[model samples]
Target: MTGSGARSVYIASAEGDTGKSTVALGVLELLAATGGRVGVFRPISRSEAGERDYILDLLLQFCSVDIPYEECIGVTYDEVHADPDAAIGEIVARYHAVAEHCDNVLVVGSDYTDVASPSELSYNARIAANLSSPIILVVKALDRDPAEVKAVADVLMADIKSSHASTVGIVANRCRPHRRTDVLDALRDTGVQAWALPEEPLLTAPTMAELREALDATLYSGDETLLDREALDVMVGGMTAEHILERLGESMVVIAPADRSDVLLALVNANSAAGFPQLAGIILNGGLRPHPMIDGLVRGLRPTLPILNCEHGTFETARIASHTRGRMATGSVRKIDAALTLMEQNVSQAELVGQLDLHAPEVMTPQMFEYQLLAQAKSDVQHIVLPEGGDDRILRATDRLLRRGVAKLTLLGNPDSVRRRASELGIDLADVDVIDPTESELIDEFADAYTELRKHKGMTRDRAVQVVRDESYFGTMMLHTGRVDGMVSGAVHTTAQTIRPAFEIIKTVPGVSTVSSVFFMCLADKVLAYGDCAVVPDPTAEELADIAISSAKTAEVFGIEPRVALLSYSTGGSGSGKDVEKVQQATELVRERADDLRVEGPIQYDAAVEPSVAATKMPDSDVAGRATVLIFPDLNTGNNTYKAVQRSAGAIAIGPVLQGLNKPMNDLSRGALVSDIVNTVAITAIQAQNLKNGK
Candidate 1:
């Protein structure tokens, strides 16, 4: 995480049981760890609903939040519903009062106790906007379909966007194991980072302490530790001894009349037996206690189970027990630990924290950059093809992309092998177009066209036929024939193998002689484009100029303002060499070609980025210290520098995104994760969109 240094970030959801507290606890811990004054503010308190609002207590227990509980929370839901305008004003006033003493604030959004409405999203978005904070939306995924989850998110996000609020990320908590992938798939391309949290049994199961509180039962016997066990199931003791013995199981809470001596003895004997599971506890119903003789006998037996005596009748006690669900209150160390662990494993700290504008100048964050790429790609979904469909990563990424509707896909592989593998991974690829190159009807036509296209280079028709059989060539043929808008390869293949077909078939766009590449370098608080990192080694001054121009345009296409920086060992004529001279000449050419581009030249990497360094080196340059598009003088320098920043700064480098191709095509790193592939495909889709626009 960059820093839990954000002043305030609202965690919002319209549905109940969103496991919002667990999400809030995780974000709270991060904010608390910042070692600054951190606070939690709930815009609407749940205390007025006859239930204690423990979220503030849970966060206030941290050593960093010194404010009292009353100061951190705003008015109640009833108050808000009564006077809408007055409620927002009170929430703002209360939130600012807390913020005045804190370095960071994590605002918990209001609960929608009423029926779901578009006004719910609007109301929360308005409050958060008034608080001057971005949002992290939470969605409940326990029993909902993936599409339903997406629908819920779409509704909220649309409202958030229209209300002029923004979300850095969305979390689907209580997501089922089988539905995890599907939830993520549905949530993708929402223009924010998304994660699916698996259901944690402990967080949802009722503990003895919770049941005792809810029932208002008096613990007549056994020590306090006995109350810590959970009631995984329930049983009634009005039945016979044989029936009670038959139902013996672990973590079972039995409700029996205080005088049911037979059933009590049977349960005790079964629990003592080697094969029987221990009981969670026993409840003595109807305000009755054990007989003197029975009590002596039970004391002599030395049982460890706790006994709670309830004033309510048997039916009422049983009903109360059945309806008690778990609540995470302060001082319950075990449940809190489980909730924190669930959040830590499921939520992405890096992605969520990276979106925070914790520092100065409100830099373009990685989340902003990624969301722009995904939104632009999905705005006009493009048809893309993958050559390495045999790879599991490709199949998994394809499932996600298809589910997200980011792009229509065609896979070049043997259908049986691809389907078999997809089935093993529980992925449904029924909608994807699978083309076996050997059996493809277009293979002969592709071979003939290829032979003609390369005939001037002494290509033979038989050789061209065999070359067209390769999946890479077959995919290139698809793009050349306009069957798909773009292609992404190189998961199992090398970079040269992936791009060679494109270079031969699609060639360069008009007026583009040199092929170059750029990596969107995602740093802690900002996203920068590092160019010529994967292509055109030792580029001439003219090629360098072209790379700079293309990189700036790519930056702009995805919403980054382009301030071009041409890097070298020197800073503004301070050093003289062939490298420096080439960079200086490239800078002049960039300014000549792009009269509107803000460019700084022959600058060291430090001077190009750090404001203090820029102030010392090139005080008057506009691009110095503020460049979003960095063009290295050569490929070796660009590649090594990007890798260095990626490793040393823990930045995400999404690229080797190839430019200058007439058709949109990209090469992936062989070690790419499924997420990496998804991002690259989206980048390619946006590139295809631009190419289609003839930009």
Candidate 2:
């Protein structure tokens, strides 16, 4: 359990067919009932045909989770089998990607399949340990004796305990009704929480689709939707029609030769009878098709029953279908509801949820950070204006922003040109507000307001009118007069062009002197904040301290804990230079002015991030080697370093998100992608939210 307010648990089984999916579904339902956002993850899936994982798909369909299907699966079992070393890292990375946005995630481990290695248990343990997730192991106790089941449980418990993952509880699935009490008593002294789930035949019955796949059968006639109907058992129609009618059971798939028209007719009649059990479907073996008259008669029924033809003989098809386990289909409400109820009755929901440890230290991975940004932006809708609306990337991002309901957009451009470009891109702009700054009706009003604000610098209204003609200046005026909540530009313009208007109009926030910017450096594993990267080329010691404070505050807004690291060429007192002294002075000033902040001074790049270097360089400093916000000494170093890391390491750099502004005004790189624009727009919206709440 962590105090970070995010929680996750890993569910694993000792072997294949242990009813793990049932426990996973039950847990997901329990968590969702609390009204918190829940997510599901399959770290190692067995889906080889490029089809979606059945468990993952089922959970997404039934649960209230809002993420895409592909986002829930980490990697396939074959990928891990081919290269175990590299696959582990990919699994953890992908899990973090999906887990960041969820309040709680139920991680389903791999099913012990034949294609997987014998060391699968070890692999699952390693995965659980890496994720720091508590384990809820599910063990099968159907066929084995009570003592044998106890032995298996003991070994699994020992292995999990040795792996350093806390075993929260164990669910003994499919235990025989007669021996369930004995099995529970045998494992009572294992020193761990355990539940014995009795075998429920209905919960394990295969659906008609599973039978068809297992027998490689062809559907001769039936509605495709009825394929999901559960078959309680397989009955062979080897006797006369009258004899087969007497043996028919509820939800049974009758297996016989295709030429057995009498048996087929009798089964259909039995399904129609109110007193008899409903026939799930019929499978004709020996590669045989029914007579045309019989098929016509069956299809003539008001509600057609499923009929499948297979090439195998009756015994072979029956053998295959018997081995197939029932799986809950995506929309099978009856089966899904039954499975959830079964688990809810047997498993201890309160105990399992209590051990999830929701407060664990929340590590803000890149994916989680981006998801949080979008989620925060949507919480309170904000209107933002884009000055460079002529750019295709801006227009495309506008489409996505509006489609997702993240923010309301107003594009500042020539309306005709903007409409023409949008048409060429096949984007709809009906919901977006397009404004041509030169022809707008509010031009005079905006010009008058701008002239009043800048009248001390220049005493002419003509100059103000011309300045307002520029889109950047006009957009900034909209923010100044509260016409828009935020502004984002610079896609096809310079940073100065975008920020100059903001500086002249909105200025800096109160008690703040220097205006600075920070780029959210999204590395593969974590997200870091790089400050003073785009603005403030050179600054005095006082200006540097202000930038550090502002950068730290900016990081907090985006869910990052700020440990400010003042980067310099020298580490502590190791070297003497004018540049190094400036950083040292700035670090001291930040500490004295904001005593609550964790500040470290004159630290080298390696010392600021690498723990080993910090131990030798500055062991007593808290921010050394663990910095989340890096404050650069000058623009030359900050800009070059950010680009180098971004290009060399393939890191995603978001912004020059401007800080210390009275209102939110951000700048973008000239070669920004559509996704970059989308992210910047979302960031601006969130910043607007903060200002609206008076943060």
Candidate 3:
């Protein structure tokens, strides 16, 4: 669990059909439960279609695993078979690409589908060893002798050790209930940590989708939601309807001829009744369809049974269903739950998770930052107000945020206009609260509150009422009155228009001399905080120091270890000028006020980012080239530099996240994308959380 870089574990099997996916799922769940942003990779995938790997796709879809489906695969089996050497190179490269951004990665080894090559097992070992990942070997043990289990473990351990892949543990899957203890003992005697998983019939039975795939069947009528149902047993409807009905077991798939409306009707009626067994599906053999009258009757009943028509006869269809294995579909919650429950109950999750080295590195990637951001925002849901409700980007982001359940949103605009725009854009705002600032029932009360807060600034009741008509002031007042936890604006308004009300009403936090902002520069490899980018055009030395301190705190809040760098044209007094002297003075002020902070100042950008350049420029300073929070001397430099990096390096600049605020309020660019709006909203929600926790 403690490593210098991203830690990875590879799950491999010596032979095929070992149910390694179950182990992978359990591992993913354990890692996720422990607050790990876990990623998955399949080194050599067996899927021929241009689709995602089934197990990896399931994890991404259902487990809240923050990884792309394409990122989960390395290479296809055909590509590997064509050129093994090139395939290995590509696989290693892709695996590292995924592993670099994750705290922990679950590398799934190849499923030995191609038996033409006898070196498939060795190939898996080679891939695992090359990646420097620890291996967890899974072996099938159902109905096998203890001696055979031991032999498999011994051979696999030898091969893995020979290939220089460390074996952290071994799992004997599908072992019989009575033989589990003996098999586990045998595995442990081989000097490896071991666990035995009993054979689960529900896991092995074919699902509706798998049956359809195997028989190339067509679905005539059934609920689409029932397609994930598992066919636990197969029954042939060759006998009379009453006899067949008596023979039907729980979750049975009935295979009958197309003309046997009596059998089909009996099954359907039984399914609809209370005490009878529920059929998983009905396979109509011989390309059969019910009679016109029976079809109309079935349609009228609208039973929830999934009906499939196949060309094969009753016995052949039954045989095919029996041989076919169940597959985990994208939305199959039952099987996923079963897998997780099975592993959690059987496997030593604490020990297994502890064995994984998952220490994150000093630098954070964009994906990691986004994942952490979402997780942080969801930790405590907060209500956020968006003043630019008429903008498509804001509306779209509102929809996404609601869908993800990250925050509660209140859009400020004319209610009718907001609804019309949302409808035109095909966005759903049913859950969002849309308010008209002028027509609100609380206008007079809000005017009174605003007058009380701004009386010293020469505000009157009439003027306060007029000012409250503006959506920005109204939204900011909502924050001040604790109606909403935060506010995000500036998409369709100037920065002054968006932030002026906040500056007047919300004000700055206690002990904060200046209100500043920081942009989270999401570079390709790591995230850096660039401060004073969108606010504070000019500041004195003391104010600059405050910005540095505030930016460092922002970095810390977002999981970046802040090493402050007071950036300038000079490096440690190498040059003399007004700008350089001001930067040096600010650095000294930071040292005086925040002595505990690690800071270096009057450093050039090259020295602050390039280690080799720092070695020649300022070698003795800890933050010379490893600064995670960069404090610019002026707004001109900060804004231009952030933009340059954003355009040239393709970095995602995720702010001007305002700092030093009594309550959380953030601004966005006029050209902000929907994703940018979503991220900004999440950031504001997290800032609100900080205030709630009294951080």
Candidate 4:
């Protein structure tokens, strides 16, 4: 959890037979194969003869270390048992041990009965929160019903949201080998990250070899070649005979023709009843098909099942039935292929955590911001500052944001002026607090604090107090003294005026040496983050390193993992210069300092994004060609590149979302749109929640 580019991943499930451990093992193996130092954690287990140990043993065989099974999962018992509150604490502690030994730890879920027992459905969520790791859900595709799977997924998502845990995605294991498309389609409907991992053919057909080898050459009337293969979802049609009826239980047999009238009558009777088998239907062949009696039966039973007919003899139908088994047998190779495809689309653990934060209960809907024209929604600490205090648009927006729960309203102007402007514009500010800057209750308080903070700069309290009289200073002071959680005011003012106060009063958070900004480059289905565009003119290696970390954190806030690529003219070893060296050094510094972050750089845009290009230039580098967070060495590069990507590539660029501040503080471009304001507000509120959560 605390090593270089190595973060802990927690896999869990809300239901039984979800295949949590198996999927977790496969993910650990996949990441480890990519040169990641991985560790496994099974938070709780109930085993009789240490079967869990065997599973963990298999995991260690693929990992870089040989940790004990106990180390793999923090807690284990002989039988199924779990204590809700204690399980989370114990699991986190256990994962901490494993995480200490490796760069990342993968926590696997136990049985659903165990995960859901003791309390209800809080087990897996609690574990993810306790460990602060992203969660991967394992879904089993045994029943071949997408709706069933979706129901399970819905419960899992709700639980994850409720527990405030970071859930990365989901893997559907033990899928029918050839039904990947169907299962994948089903998973997509859930609106959650899901993959159908293949079940091995050999595993599915454990008895195939033995069955083929043991079969007597003359046991059946059908050709042996006809029985060579089988389908998984097969149907067997048998002519209703006394011998077949006795042995019908051996297969999914549908008896027919023995009594067209009786069978039709029975079918009609069963058709009207509920909970009957969804049969492949009955076949009446040989020209002795259903008569009027059968016709009546067929018509009546049509609602329940379908019926098919042919001119072929009973022998042909029997032959086809025998061959159905081969077609119906599920294979494992297809499952493996699907797993690989899923692995290709797999999002990193960090991305999932960020999504959870975005969807937290405290967040406000974008519509709320749009209706009111407020840029952000804040919960618990709602009071905000409006720099353009007398504007009617600000008042209306304030009311909207307030009603929609964006934040508490604080207008920075005279009550009379704001009210008169609202009346002129038919806007209502009845519930909004109009803080006339000249008569503000906190103006004197801010003046004193301002003087104290700037006292050493040769400025007297009078000058400092005079400077503090500005609206920006009042807003900045409110943020500093906890009167407000954040401030969004740059529309009617220059960037300098909006940011200067924050730089002077709010200051950067500790351990973050610089304040930087990034742009959220959004597309229809994806987003890429560009950083160092607003601050740090010509950052040094150390400063660039800080930019990468800060950018990744910012990307996380917007529901993306920061796979940072420190951009330069060349990738890998193509070009050489101090600028390039700075980028390379900055990348290394980021890796060294933030072991938990994933970043690679000193690479060109192509190499950082194109898998083939990256593979050719940096075959062994993990971040190359898969970078999500692009770190620019200087403000010029960051700004120009992001603008190009936005305009030429048709990417919808959002932000200039300021990062590394003590609280949420954003700068709006003069040309920012209403939609942009709404989104900025969402991002800010999400950031506020993250800061509140201390991440």
Top candidate on lDDT is 3
lDDT of each: 0.81, 0.82, 0.83, 0.61
Candidate 3 local lDDT, 128-184, one digit each (tens): 888888898999997698889999888888888887778889999999988999988
The 10-residue segment of model 2 with minimum total lDDT is: 359-368
Which whole-number lDDT from 0 to 100 does residue 210 have in model 1?
79
lDDT per residue as tens, model 4, 115-182: 34653346667777777777777777776576776677777777787888765677776676677657
Clashes of each: 0, 5, 1, 26
For every model shown, what is its TM-score relative to the native structure? 0.57, 0.54, 0.59, 0.47
Residue 360, model 4: Cα distance from true site in angstroms: 19
- Residue pairs that clash (backbone atoms under 3 angstroms), model 2: 1-357, 2-359, 2-360, 3-359, 4-359
Write down the lDDT that model 3 would get. Answer: 0.83
Q: What is the Cα-based lDDT of residue 157 in candidate 2? A: 81
The per-prediction CA RMSD against the true structure, in angstroms, equals 15.8, 16.1, 10.7, 23.8
lDDT minimum window of 10 residues, candidate 3: 58-67
Which of candidates 1 and 2 reaches a greater TM-score? 1
lDDT tens digits, residues 574-682, model 2?
A: 9898999999999999999999999898999999999999999999988898999999999999999999999998777889899999999999989898778889999
Candidate 1 per-residue lDDT, tens place, 81-190, comes to: 78878999998888878887766788998767663234876888888887788899999999899999998898889989888888888998888888998899999968
- C-alpha lDDT of residue 410 in model 3: 97
